[model samples]
Target: MHETRTIADLALEVRSKNAGPFWVTMELFMRDAVGYTIVADPAYLNASTVARLYGIDADTVQIFRLPALHVVKISFPRPVSQGSLRDRDIHAGQHHVPLALFPLPSP
Candidate 1:
């Protein structure tokens, strides 16, 4: 039989690096922690999706179960400026980039 896990479990796995690499921000981690503490509800999430939402690039997404208080570690290629990426404007008819989602173990 297949097992099912909650989003919180996945989050913990990501934080711990027991799963894989994912790009997550300090703010999103905080929100997830607080939301869990307050409501105990979990939402399915992927690093690339979160990055796109935050305007971070796909290459920077890493998978790991990071502590809620841990600082976000985002690095860019030498020619790519992090600040510029943050301030970069989306062109007309832009679409989301394709990124692979890490797999999670059954709960």
Candidate 2:
């Protein structure tokens, strides 16, 4: 296994929100470019890895890296529509717990 650190160790804030009725997005904001670079690597933060964390198909996930802002954003299809009677998360905010638990490679 790779040497790793929690996102909490590098990100200034980690948040999740609803993109729409069908999607949830997670945002990881790092304090600076050095921290951002460490977590921004595709090897550690990508669709397939995130899909595994959320127990979803890789095709349903998308990742964006914003070097200028030192942030990483990820969007994925939700199994249920937002605010649907069957939905477990309404704001889509709490879904970021899984992302927080994912380990980033150590620099």
Which model scores highest in TM-score? 2
Prediction 2 global C-alpha lDDT: 0.87
Model 2 over residues 1-107: C-alpha lDDT tens digits? 75567887788999999999999999999999987887788877888888888899999898899999999999999879988899988989799887886776644
What do the candidate models score in CA lDDT, each in turn?
A: 0.32, 0.87
Quantify how close model 1 is to the true structure by its C-alpha RMSD in Å. 11.3
Off by over 4 Å in 1: 1-34, 37-43, 67-107
Best by lDDT: 2
Evaluate residue 73 in candidate 1 and report its C-alpha lDDT on the 0 to 100 scale. Answer: 24
lDDT of 1 by residue, 1-107 (tens): 75543333323322321111221222123235543332222233445544654466656655334445532322222222323454242221111112112233333
Instruction: State TM-scores per candidate.
Output: 0.26, 0.90
